[model samples]
Target chain A: MTDTYFVAVDWGTSGFRLWVIGRDGTVLDSTTAPLGMSRLKRNDFDRVLEESLDKLGIAQDVPAIICGMAGAAQGWCEAPYLCAPTRLDALGEGAVSVRGATRNVHILPGVKQMAPANVMRGEETQIAGLLHAEPSFAGTVCLPGTHTKWVQVKDGAIQHFETCMTGEQFAFFSQTSVLSHSMILDGWSDNAFRSAVRLATQDPVAVPRRLFSIRADMLVRDQDSATARATLSGLLIGQELMSVVHYWRDQSVTLIGAPPLCEIYLMALDVLGVGGRSLDVETTTLAGLAAAFHIQTGTVHA
Target chain B: MTDTYFVAVDWGTSGFRLWVIGRDGTVLDSTTAPLGMSRLKRNDFDRVLEESLDKLGIAQDVPAIICGMAGAAQGWCEAPYLCAPTRLDALGEGAVSVRGATRNVHILPGVKQMAPANVMRGEETQIAGLLHAEPSFAGTVCLPGTHTKWVQVKDGAIQHFETCMTGEQFAFFSQTSVLSHSMILDGWSDNAFRSAVRLATQDPVAVPRRLFSIRADMLVRDQDSATARATLSGLLIGQELMSVVHYWRDQSVTLIGAPPLCEIYLMALDVLGVGGRSLDVETTTLAGLAAAFHIQTGTVHA
Candidate 1:
């Protein structure tokens, strides 16, 4: 039997990315589509997968591993969540197989925190990747995005985590709320952002009032649009920090997300007098998916 | 010259209500329209008012006193906000006249707080009405609505106030957010609401996390949608209370709004162990507009 390579896919709600990896885990090719899980039907996932493989000039027999919303109940195949306190490498074991596919396909399950009732899909794969990179990593991992996750990993296992809808709330408020009038789509104010963070940290309960005050400031104080945008971002991020700072305040914190957002989190952390380092979410997710793929095919230790 | 009754209009952002009040302050007739400030262009306000008067068979010669968004800069006439630390009765003094109108039309000015930069249009009229009803009322006035106003009244004057976008945020989040899927629009759970209130009051910063947990709870525990809706409401109101409970905690609080929403605020205040009494917003606005009308015509004391 000839052993060649496989594809790793991070199929999120609003995005899709596929990477063809060499037998030794080198990325041979990659492609992405805006056709995310939300935009695809159940059968459409298989069709899209085949089309993506064809575009990449990959054979139908090549195996593939998937992560994120693709594993959700509404996705291609429902990959039931693996309850927490579970080892990161064990993600592959909870993966559900995509039956009737010409190629070998599996979807990784998400992590679920039952007590507080929080669930994370694609981020769990990123955590798995982070764990694979730093096998002995302990303390907290902050994954910032639309739904930012703060995970505690010790001894190669995720202890517990929390999710904040800070990014989504920012998107919703800036685009649809009254604050939209005062916000610029692009550009930011560092000073305003940091000042907002300090204000939120000092009196976290005043966040709701502060949010309205952003508009009032714009109207009464003639605040700039860039400052308004940054202040909004800072307020939401600050609120998130106020809630979850306890998770990383006393420990080493590593952020994983797009550089821009991670930088904001880092700045927020700095404002709170806490230290944090950032890692690329894409790299972590790819590494995590590749690690899961390796574990599934028995090429690596779990 | 004969002195006849005049019309009092509480024109808000999304609603318009007009009451014909006699010289003795009795409501002779009343009517309402969905044509609020947001729905009308500058020219449309005059036409709408004229049409509304025609529908009620009102004489064009009879003068009208307007409050709320009709007095906004974007409305028929710009009634600049009266800065705080001013008596509620003095609202009449800031009234702006509608130019080229067949009948005498005066739009009462809103109240603005400069430091924290808060503004209230129609609620000021309601506050004025509250003051008219209780001239010696010295404490907090919570006018709950799309923008809930927490006004500090002392010696019949509005000292300062803060605006919480609680109701607006609730509307936006429940209608447009991921949490929308987990929410049932109509039914509510009192238990879930109170529990969420307690959760928010105890750890106000956990609000962003608690919001996402509603979706998580629905997914993991199959929580009911009604419970999710109530919880969302409770969380927002609780956060509002956490921020401004100081205003009402040590003083008398008069709740003013439609009964349903005012009940929620009352319940929230009750959870905080603060006593409050509810007042009808319409009645308050009528009394307020009437009081302002009398003052504008120099028929009563300011």
Candidate 2:
């Protein structure tokens, strides 16, 4: 059994994940919690961190590297944002060390694009892991989530990126808005999804006006809740696709998110006659954290 | 003093307005309440109506004529939608009488379109009022609200229309979404609103992608809460404007809504280099109710 080298943590907005790295620079053990910075204070973070360490029987002296909203100003401490056109190979260089934590915790900085005004935290670490796997890869990387990110990479650097509130809007429309009464959480319709995606892709401007159709169709045509749910998903993703046509058109594309979410995005892209590959978010997140550890410490993993 | 004839009620989703029509066919006395169909049960509506009639010391024998969300299926009683290509001068033809009410309460039916699957409740009454004022009015009638309605009128009938959830989106963005922390309820930034509206009109597809900028601009440029709020408003209205360009472009436009809301739409139209006329909503609702009263009862007001 090797000594723990460090702990890699992905402390996101609504959840937390931790991994103990052995001296061989591999994950020895891991744990996750529903701890997020949005509702908890710095003291809560400390308590959670201690509990997580105890869960893995890791010693107090082992350092930790964290990413995501844990770095937000409203989070544990302000890690601040690294401006865009940023290089991917050395994201850990911008890590901000938590001053009064239980251990030496360094929070990775997020990235910001100024003109169109966009920002992201944890996604930067994933991009770093991506560069580690394909250093020369140059294309569009789409990471779909509540706030989906579209990153343009060239020559190991992030050229530009944009964030769309597609997932959040979907949740709002289907859960809180007038469409809520007509939506079914457990139902789906692929054909409905594909048709909506195609309509939205072709006439993106009509989306705002078209949203009420779900309610109207439910009243008049008795549109299925499953079909309504799929339409909602399709319209959001399709509208997002229209904004990023320039990024994805005639370019190699990769999607990094939960499989189900990525599957939906992939299906949306298929509607546009575009193709892309999907990467598991957790795997890339861990790889990105490991890559950061190696890149910053001048250490190589087996 | 003329004898009371009937009560004209504009019962909306969130508020209520009423006018007592005299035997001479003009407003005799009036009162309003915060009554709305969205929150109250059908029995609650009966109680409110009775109370409202008592407020003005009107007799139980006096009938009531109602419009707006009171006609929704979830309303007092189902005032089933009157399908479109609906005639503007005779909307009362589709009125559904409230069977068990204290008096002869008639809830005017809303209008529905099949192919695009759109529906409107209260706005049709406003349109009827517009036709009363301008009997041969042709072109777009824009009624801005939580769900702003764009109605096309020609040959004394509603040819087509669409609904945009602009105001609702603004509410969500400024009060419920990530931009909530950065928004000020009493803020005003006309320049920011104009700029955002123009951008959205030109590229509506980018609205969803650009929403995060309110948060980003607040983070990076320290964008003003007023500016952030106005930008949010601009983006939503701009996106809606893109969808209705064909309706407002190269046409006579009349905006019928609350003065403040209509002012915003007028400004947006100005940004598009288009001109429109705004009507006070309360006045129009009264005129609409009166028009329905006259058209149905064949009585003329002096």
Candidate 3:
């Protein structure tokens, strides 16, 4: 048996990560770098990657697997989007060829949707990881993050997905909009979160009015900044809740991803009366890459 | 002929103004400063008035009258809001006894609508000016500014008013929102303005989705920053147009205030097919105060 060190990389827009794993699928070592795609040109990918690995005392000959936005057209390479009903075995194994690297560097493909103009990168791995963690699940699995993806997994295959701007809109309104000054940098308000869920659930039609009130209440009435944050969170989340009510009406949801993000969606789900459970798909991207690797290497785990 | 110089003052929240005028309402001299109500304590009205006069090289004893937000609760004094169907002459007339100023400083009351939670402080004078400029004019008078006021003046009386947050929303979105980076601050695009008006008129439902598209287009397709500005303008102005469509549907509009503000409203009015004329009620605050002065003192035209 030729033992190989496979590096799993999750490179986002802001940072890069590389985890070296043994044949036994345990992380032997890991390394990270601040060289994100946002700061690099099309040609600088190889140099940056080599330098990142060199910093971690890793040789260039290590076989690797990459995921996330690093494979976008503007990233290291453009990874084609995987279509629906795609299983772990269906993701064809290939490597993005780079010079002077003795080992193969495979990049995972993302997913895309035409309607409502939505796309996702690197989430496929996470979805694959979800499937790996729960080999036989049948429900709407929501991966809520920067670009929230609600994927329908049933009969052991990825059926379809819809992307929501809930996360991005929240960040935009919180940090970029006038509501920023009113929202505290840190601190959780379940009261706000719950009220937001209620507002979204009850008077969803009044979203346009509520958005302005978020600022007006703070500036004119001198409402507490904390309340403003809560109100704002509620407003955006509420708006999203309204937008996606039809999807959750008769479906069970399995929420995957971080806690806070999942918690917010869970609250909305509770308000929406969608019976669901949240599962922390541990290191989903790694699991996804491993599944894809196993499917390619003809390793049968069953 | 009692040649008492009729002083017209445009006193509002931000500042106070005193215009020394001949009996015919021809200004002899005028002065203004930042002695707005914000700097004044409850009893400091007298001192603030004196200071404003001193800045304008006017005597503290100058006979002056004021209008606008200066009479609100937080102002130098709380001048009550007058209800609709009230003539200019029916506004509260009383002498506020400010110490150290020989002239009697009378503050004008603002107009309020209790049912819809709306109020206009400074525009009352402008509305009065519009009425004074065009008495026997029965139609809609659109005062387009920071808080765009669509006021109905019927049968030579201020009938009703509603304020839309057009200008302020524009400023907030243009500067604070994600659209800020893309807006061309040097000048505005009339084409963008027209398109926005058309969009608002035709499909008012798509405004919110279109707002998000600005970011997506910029990021994915590398759209111009200028498109962001026009798009925002379209969304907001379209929203404003939609909001005040009822006012413009069956009536002609007389746009009051400065040129640019009037132009946008005029554009919107044109879109609504309301035959309108932009009446530059230049220095409306002064003219309003002058008319108020004439009404109070029973001064004949010189």
Candidate 4:
């Protein structure tokens, strides 16, 4: 039995989730808090790390691997962002250095592609987890989150990936836009989503023209909020799928994320006549951290 | 000349504009303030009026006529709303009681049409001003503002009108929507507006399809904010014009309000192949009140 411990942290904008694991990658204990990177002040990452570790009864000396925006420029530590079209081996220089931490800490770098404005911070971890989950998981692996990522997983490795701001944009439009008054705020409406997806995929070119119909249909026809939200979601996801269908069609796709978000990707795939299966890689971040920690310490357990 | 002075109060939601005129309809002194009906607390309207009148150097005894939302359910005083397809004679019941200072205050009632979900409070004054400018003007008098009004003017009367929440929707979408990041905040672009208008008018039925394309074009082609703004404006105005083109194609249109807002209307008319002249009815409320006063007092000046 090995005494070396491993930890995986999925730190998002507003929340931090950490999973404590043993040598076999079995989660021993898990904890979550609202201390996301956005709430931290300048140069306060060390204190936050201590607080997180203290809550878990984990010693500062225990090595931990972190992913997500924690390593972003706005993160607790200014971990350099890795350029996109990247791979797990080419994650470059690894996590940022922090001072005054109770234990050794390493934050994963996010990938950013300049050409198409694609980016990912946390989805890379999920992609890595999906790859780890399936050894021969070649083809495309999609991890949907606030920023949905389309990663090309080949030869047991994450070769390349792209991020779309579709999720964030959808939330903004549905909650804050004028259409907010006419959209479904709570609960999911698959019917509305399906019709919207149809509108988007069948006549992909008509997306720009059909947006006003959302308002007009509401005003003139009294369309319900659910339909409106679905219509909007369909348009955005449809457009994204349309752009990537050429690359994803006739290939295998592995979806990873929360069930609801993953369902959206499945729906999009189904609409495009693509075959795919969903893997419940809920703790992909932990898996990814396990992989990275092995590489960092060069400690392979028997 | 009679000693009685008439006051025309164009009290709207966010601001109040008043014109103190002699019985002959000459604007003696004008005043405007930010105390619109929407901002006033319960019973605070009297103070707003008193302060506004003090600025205009007008006494409380003047026979004042108030129009616009100042008489709605949330206004200074509830001037009963008039149903649409109404005649000029069916406006506010001669006078409404004012609480504060002693004055013969007459509030013009707003129009509320049932079928189309159209309602207007202050537009009657603009429509009245349009009739005053061209006594026998027929066809549609398009008054574009935060909420645009397309009133069909015929036989020296407002035959029918429809209201579209285009402007307010545009503002909401541009400032708070996902498109906000892709659009400009200000500065009018006629070229962009014209192109959008062309698209809207040429294919009113396809408006819903084009909305998403705006973002695509902006993202893929790096289009300017001006083009985005104009395209949005054009799409709305073009759709609106297409709705009422048959009603005013062969008749005359008198555009009212500020120069810039009126330009869009003029452009819409031009796109519809309709002839119309832009009229700067700077003090439309005062003129409207004068006409109403003449009709009420039976003065034969014209």
What are the per-model DockQ values? 0.78, 0.78, 0.14, 0.09
Instruction: Compute the lDDT for candidate 4.
Output: 0.69
Native-to-model Cα distance after best TM-score fit, residue B204 in candidate 1, in Å: 1.5
Model 1, B19-111: lDDT tens digits are 887666677788999999889899888889899899878888899999888887677888888888889889888888889887899999988
lDDT score, candidate 3, position B276: 81
Worst 10 residues of 2 chain A by lDDT: A293-302
Which tens-of-lDDT digit does each residue in A105-218 have in candidate 4?
788777665444445677777766655565566788777766566777677555565555568667766776546767755546787787778877776555543554565466
Candidate 4 chain A, which ten residues in sequence have the lowest lDDT sum? A84-93
TM-score of 4: 0.66
Q: Which number leads on TM-score?
A: 2
Q: What docking tier does model 2 reach?
A: medium
Please state the CAPRI-style docking class of candidate 3: incorrect
What lDDT does candidate 4 reach at residue A17? 84
Q: If you superpose only chain B onto the true chain B, what TM-score does each candidate give? A: 0.96, 0.96, 0.88, 0.89
- Candidate 2's residue-wise lDDT over B57-110, tens digit each? 999988888998998988899888888898966667677778888877888888
Q: Write the per-residue lDDT of candidate 1 for residues A225-264, one digit (tens) a residue.
A: 8899999998888889889867977776899999988899
Instruction: For residues A1-302, write the lDDT of model 3, one tens digit per residue.
Output: 32446677878777887777777788777788887787888778777776777776776667677777778778877877665656644553633444444456767777654444345677777777877877886777788776567676777666666665566666766775545756755556778777877875675544544554565455445667677777777766666655555456788787878887788778767766778777764477678778876765567532
- Cα lDDT for residue A198, model 1? 94
Clashes of 2: 0
lDDT of 2 at A253: 79
* lDDT value for model 3: 0.67
